[model samples]
Target: MFGPWWKLGVDTTLLAFEAQAVIGLRLAKLAAGGSAAQVEAQRMVSEKVLAAGEAAMQIATGASTGAVVAGYRRKVLANHRRLSRAPKGAAKP
Candidate 1:
């Protein structure tokens, strides 16, 4: 397993895995006009990936102070909340 500092987006393979996790069985959902759900799912992936990558980068660069980690976490969580509020009947994208 990748360490906490792993940046999932930078690696094509990791991103492909993340996409598969969210979209593999959800094609039908999209076709059913489930864009909101898809968007929400993508948001979760983005939050998780970004947190891991940013945290790792911070520690790697000796910048993972308490405030830095807390701020990064807050940002990720806030983004998730925003993404999750999308309209359920939103158009498919």
Candidate 2:
């Protein structure tokens, strides 16, 4: 902890992760043996996926995504509501 005062403020974890990811993507691209256009397309797709993940993170922090979850939950509750009040093989008089 006493090595350097400046080192404590800087965390290299994310920088390391990005470096490793670049290496991994390079290896994957080489293994694919595709044309330049295909490699470019793959790169674009990966970037888009990263953007989507970022958006999901933003949605997680915001209050709007809850509405989508609530809509699905409401449908599930509607489906089960009738079953709770009625028994199978029983008929109304």
Candidate 3:
């Protein structure tokens, strides 16, 4: 049925909104200043670029919107877990 596709569309929209909010918060934190703020900003840019490239490749290979979005959600959650466990001022290499 069309129900699944409709759900996927809604989920994708929600994901996009969540990602933007998180990115905005990160930018605000960076602007507020910290020893590792510069590194965090650079990491954010690199991560987004890499994720976009991967998503584009997946779409080119005929992956569904749901699949691409799920992948993004997984990556974002993993990064959140990793960052949460790290020391406050530590920057990952």
Candidate 4:
């Protein structure tokens, strides 16, 4: 049950990490070809924005995965309960 969720979480984290790395590379490009001072300032701002974006992505991904797992568990449990309560050795009308 939880195995699938763990796998999904790991895959999500990896994807997010890759996306952040791509963004970091693009930011580096954008921060390039400027006066030393200007480049430094822009680099600082880019770093902050990139960090914030990565953090937000992680949080959102985690929350969404948790919600999906919770919903699935709830559904499975409900079905199990329903089956447990069903009469045995009876024919359907």
**What is candidate 1's lDDT per residue for 1-93, written digit by digit as tens?**
665445422443444454454453345445555665578568657877877887788888887455454655466445445434545687866
Which is the better candidate, 3 or 4, if ranked by TM-score? Answer: 3
lDDT of 1: 0.56
Q: What is the C-alpha lDDT of each candidate?
A: 0.56, 0.49, 0.79, 0.55
TM-scores of all predicted structures = 0.44, 0.28, 0.72, 0.33
Clash tally, candidates in order: 1, 0, 0, 0
In the range 13-90, model 3's lDDT, one tens digit per residue, is 877876776676676668867766787888888999999999999999999888999989877766655554656677
What clash pairs does model 3 have? Answer: none
Alpha-carbon runs more than 4 Å astray in model 1: 1-33, 80-93
Ranking by TM-score: 3, 1, 4, 2
> Which one wins by TM-score: 1 or 4?
1
Alpha carbon lDDT of residue 66, candidate 2?
39
Worst 10 residues of 3 by lDDT: 77-86
Better of 1 and 3 by lDDT: 3
Indicate whether candidate 3 or candidate 4 has the larger lDDT: 3
In the range 1-93, model 2's lDDT, one tens digit per residue, is 654433422323333444455555545555666584376467656765765675577577784543434433443344334323534566966
